[model samples]
Target chain A: MMDPQRLKYTREHEWVGLESPGVALIGITDYAQDQLGDVVYLALPEPGGRVVRLQKFGEVESVKSVSDLFSPVNGEVLAVNQALRDHPELVNQDPLGEGWLLRVRLANATELNTLMSKAEYERFLHREGG
Target chain B: MPELLRTSLYDAHKKLGAKMVDFHGWEMPLHYPAGILAEHRAVRNACGLFDVSHMGRIALRGQGAAALLDLLFTGEIDDLPLGKARYGFLCNEKGGIIDDVVVLSLAPQAFLLVCNAASWDRALGWVQQWSPRFEPVEIVPGREETAMIALQGPAAAERLETLAPGLSTSLPPFAVTSEVVAGLLVTVARTGYTGEDGFEFILGAKEGPDLWRALLKEGAAPCGLGARDTLRLEAGFRLHGQDMDEDTTPLEAALGRFVRMEKVFVGVEALREQKRAGLSRRLVGFTLEGHDIPRAGYAVRAEGQEIGRVTSGTFSPTLQRGIGLAYAPPRHAEPGTRIIVDIRGRDAPGKVVALPFYRRKQGESSLASL
Candidate 1:
C-alpha cells in the first residue's frame, strides 16, 4: 500500500494540490503507477495548453499497455515534467513527488471538490483493486 | 477478479518479487525487481533466461503423420529431416492463420509442434479434425510435465557451454538433441524468439527448478516476459492473438511468406481468393519520431485520416527509441513512408521502416553478413 497522507487525489488515481496555488502539481498516484509497471514513455500536453476536467491530457506507455492521463481539473498546463522524457520510470518510482507529470495553473478552486479525498481515494483504489 | 493461470515456475517468480500479470491466461512475470530496461539491456549484453513452459507442446507420432501434417500445415514438413525444426502456420479454412507454430520433426512419421499457449485448444482441435483423414493422431492436452527455458543473448552460447559444454556447437539453428545435463535429460535447441544468438531447452518439469537455479548461478540473469516482449518486438516476431488471429490472414499480417501456395492446406482456397482480391491492410513497422511510445490499439493516422491500429509497440532498449508494429493501408505500409500514431488523442509523428528494428550481431564467418 502507498502512503495516503502525502497528497490529495482523484477517483481516477491522479494526485493534485502538492504545490502552491496557481501552480498546482498533477501526477498519477502510487497505486496507479504500480499497476501500470515499468513506464517507458510519456505523452504530456504542451505547456500553455488548456485542459478540461475528465478529458485526456496525456498518456503513459508501459511495456504492457498505454494509459490515458485524465485531467482532474480545468486548467492551463504550465509545464510538463521534462525528467520523464528520458526516464519514464520516474513515474513508477516516485508517483506523487518527483514524478509529477505537470504543473497546472488552477482556473477555479471549486474544481477541487470534484476530486476524491485522501481517504476516499484510498477506498477508490481498494474498490478498483489497484 | 479475473483468474490467472499458473505455470510450474509461479513460485520461483514470486520468490524473485516479480511483477506478475496475466498473459494469455498464464500468470507470468512481466518484469523482476531490477526493472524492464535493465533486464532488457542484460539480455542484449549478456544472457537472460526465461521460463516459457506456458507455450503449448504437442507430440505428433504415428504412421502417416508426416503426410497428414504436410496437407494440414502451411510449410513443408516432409523435407525436414529428423531432429530439425520448421516454422509454419496452422491455417483455417479460409487461409487465415489459426496459430503460428514450430514443427520439430523427431523422425519420419513423428513430430512435435510448439504453439502459442492461448491457441493450444484451437491448434489441438484442428490437428484432431485433420489427423483422422490421413493418419492416426493422438492429441495430448495439458502436457505440462515438460518445462521450456530460453537462454538468450550474444553471450548465451558461452554461458550455456559452462552448464553443458558443446551444447551450442553441436546444435544447428532449428535442430534439437537430447542429452543428460546436470543429471537431467534435456532437449536443447538453437532457437529463440529474440533476434539474438541463443538456445531453448525443453526438460522435465521436476528438473526445471534446479536448471533455472543453475543457469542463474552460471550468470544468466532471470528475465521475465517484459524483456522477452521488447526483444521479440525488436526482432519482428509476431505474437499470436495480437498480431494475427482467425480473422487476420497471413498475407495481411506479413506472414504470407511462411505460407507455401504450392501445397494444399486447409485454407488454401481462401488464401488464393484473398491473394487474388488483394489485401486492404498490411502489417508494417514504424519508428516513433518523438517521445511517445505507440502502443497496441492506438490508431495509425496519416494526413488526419485513420489508416490503421498498432498491434505491438515498445521503447526499444537497444535503439533507445520508440518503435512498433501496425497494420496499415498499403500506401502507408511502404518503408520510409511517413505517418502518425494517435497516442491517446495526440498524433505523434512516425515513419514506416523496414523491420526488424534491431539486427542480431553477426560473427565474422556468417555468410549473411559477408
Candidate 2:
C-alpha cells in the first residue's frame, strides 16, 4: 500500500499537490507507475498548453505498452519535468516527489474540493485493487 | 460470454501468482510476479521453464502416412528422418496460411504434428477432410493429457544435465528423446521459441506440478506469455495469427523458404500464382529511432501515405530498443528502408532491418563448428 499523505488524487489514479495557491504539481500514483513498469520515454504537453479535467495531456511509454496521462483538474500547463525526457524511470523511482510530471495553474480554486483526500484516495485504491 | 480455456498446468500457474490473460482463446499466464523483463533476463542468462501445453498436438499413423503428409504440408515432410523434426506450414486451398506447424517423424509410418491451439479445430477438420484419400489419421483434441515445459537460456543445458542427469547433454539442437526428468516420463525436445539453446519438455498432466516445483528448486525462473512474446519477436519468429493469417499468404510474409513446391500440397497452385504475380505487400522488421513503442494496429506511413500497419511490436529487452514487425508496401519492405509509424497521433521514424535481432551460438555437434 502507498501512503497518500503527501498528495491529492484523482479517481483515475493521478496525483496532484498544490505547490502554490494556483500552481499545482502532478504525477501518476505509485500504483499507476507500478502497473506501467520501466518507463522508457515520456511525451509531455507544451508548457503553455491548456489541460481540462479527464482529458489526455501526454503519454508515457514502457517496454511493452504506452499509457496516456490524464489531467485531474481544469488547468493550464506552467511547466513539465524535462528530466523525464531522458530518464523516464524517475516516474517509477519517486512518483510522489521528484517524479512529478508537470506543474499547472488551476483555472478554478473550487476544483480542489472535488479532489480526493488521503483517506478517500486510500479507499479508492482499495476499491480499484491497483 | 468470456470462456476461460485452461492449460494442464493451470493450478501450478495460479500457485506461482501468474497474471493470466486470454491468448488465442486459452487462459494462459501472461507473466509471473517477477514480470516479463526479469523472466526474459533469466532465460537469457540462466534457465527458465514455460508451460506451453496450450499448443496443439496431432498424430498421423498409418501405412501411407508419410506419403499423405507430403501431400498436405508445404515442406518436404517425407524427407525427414525418423525422430527428426521439421518446420512447415499448412496452407488453405487459396494458398494462404492456415497454420504454421512442426512435424516430428517419430516413426516411418507415424508423425506428430504440433500446431497452434486456436487453429486446432480447423487443422483437425482439414486433416479429417483429407483422411479418406490418405490413410488412418488421429487428432488429439487438447494438450490436457500432456504438460509442456520449456527450459531455456545459456545455462539451461547445465541445469537440465543436473536435474535429469545425462538426459540433456548428448542432445543436439532439434533432437528429441523421451526421458525421465524428476522421475516423470517426459519427452524432451532440444528446441524452443527463444533464440537460446534449450529444451521443450512434454510431460503428463498429473506430474506437471511436481515437475514445475522441482524445476524452480533447480533455479529455472518461471516465465509467461509476455517474455515469450519478446523472445520470439527478437528471434524473428512469426506468431501464426499475427504474422500470417487466412488472408496473408506465406509468400507475402517472407516464409517462402518454408514452402517447398517440389512436392504437391493443398495450396501449391495459388502460391505459385502469387509468386508469378509478384508480391504487393511484405512483412518487414523495424526499430523506432527513439523510445516510442509501436503497437499492434498502429499505421505505417511512407511520405504521408498509409502503406501498412504494425502486426506486432515490443521493446526488445536484449537489444534495448523498440522493435516491431509490420506488413508494408513492397517498395518499403527492403532492408534499410525508412518509414514512419503513427504512434498515438504522432509520427515516429522507424527503419527496416534484418530479422532475428539475436541468434544463439551453434551447438558443439551442429554442422557448423562453434
Per-residue accuracy of model 2 over B116-164 as CA lDDT, tens digit each: 8888778877877787766555544547787778888888888876678
Task: Evaluate model 1 with DockQ and give the value.
Answer: 0.54
Task: Provide the overall lDDT of each model, using Cα atoms, as 2-decimal numbers.
Answer: 0.82, 0.82
Q: Where's the lowest-lDDT run of ten residues in candidate 2 chain B?
A: B361-370
lDDT of 2: 0.82
**Residue B9 lDDT in candidate 2:** 83
Model 1 reproduced share of reference interface contacts: 0.67
lDDT of 1 at B28: 91
Number of the top-ranking candidate, with TM-score as the measure: 2
Chain B TM-score, model 1, reads 0.95
A15-68 per-residue lDDT for model 1 (tens digits) = 887467566888998888877878887878999999888888877887767788
True contacts kept of 2: 0.40
TM-score of each: 0.88, 0.91
- Name the regions of candidate 2 deviating beyond 4 angstroms: A19-23, A34-38, A46-51, A75-99, A103-109, A118-130, B361-370
